[model samples]
Target: DQQVKQNSPSLSVQEGRISILNCDYTNSMFDYFLWYKKYPAEGPTFLISISSIKDKNEDGRFTVFLNKSAKHLSLHIVPSQPGDSAVYFCAANLQGGSEKLVFGKGTKLTVNP
Candidate 1:
């Protein structure tokens, strides 16, 4: 079973608009949440992350929000640009010791300029 899930397979947004990617998890033990962006042939690169203790974290135009009670998290990109288009994967893991990470199917985001 997948501990993490991204309900939407893809999302499209106009340039300068906002793109939101959603994720949900069935495991309550997850203490860390991470979002990664992958290009066509390159590896997934770390984008933004949020700790279970915090409700939100932001890096430049990217922001990650975690809702523990709902076991859900989301990544928000404001002023979404063409360069921001990629496959976004949401991942979760135990912060302290577990090297294991659970990842979602990934959401393909298309930014139209």
Candidate 2:
């Protein structure tokens, strides 16, 4: 019963610093929150999204924050580069029709240039 959880599989940053990705949820009926970004094999892409009423959501350098009473959600990458190395997935869904997303087995973000 892993509603969602990303207990830091990996995270390393240096190039320009600033890169935090964390997510945890026990499924309080998940209210639409997503963040996906992958490279290698290619798949996850969506990046940034928040809609549990809104706690915060950015786009530029990517930024997504949601703390629906501590269900937790985070993804902020601001200067970190090196092409912002891959793997970063945190998702949740339950708002519209078909948006079934519940993934969190990623965090591998290595950006050390």
Candidate 3:
């Protein structure tokens, strides 16, 4: 069974607009949540992360929010750009361990000019 899921496989947005990506988790034990962006043929790069203890974390144009009660999280990107177009992966680790991480299939985001 998958612990994390991204219901939307793809999202298209216009440049300079806000893009929202969502994730849902079934494991309540997850203590860390992360968002990664990957370009074609490139390894996923860490974008932002939020600890279970906090409801939200922000870095520049990217922000991640965690709702423990809802077992859900979301990533928001403001003023989306073409360079931001990539496959985003939602990941989680149990009990803050670096040993293993559960990842969602990913959502492909396209920013049109």
lDDT of 2 by residue, 16-83 (tens): 88999999999889898888789997777877788999899888888888988899989899989989
Alpha carbon lDDT of residue 75, candidate 3? 99
Tens-digit lDDT string for candidate 3 (1-105): 999999999999999999999999999999999999999999999999999999999999998999999999999999899999999999999884666799999
Worst 10 residues of 2 by lDDT: 94-103
Better of 1 and 3 by TM-score: 3
Pick by lDDT: which candidate is best? 3
Q: TM-score of each candidate?
A: 0.96, 0.32, 0.97
Point out where model 1 deviates above 4 Å: none
> How does candidate 2 score on lDDT?
0.88
- Tens digits of lDDT, candidate 1, 16-108: 999999999999999998999999999999998888999999999998989999999999999899999999999999757547888999999
Quality of model 1 by C-alpha lDDT: 0.94
lDDT for residue 104 in candidate 1, whole number 0-100:
96
Q: Which regions of candidate 2 fall more than 4 Å away from where they truly are? A: 15-28, 32-51, 54-62, 65-74, 80-113
Rank ordering of all candidates by TM-score, starting from the highest: 3, 1, 2
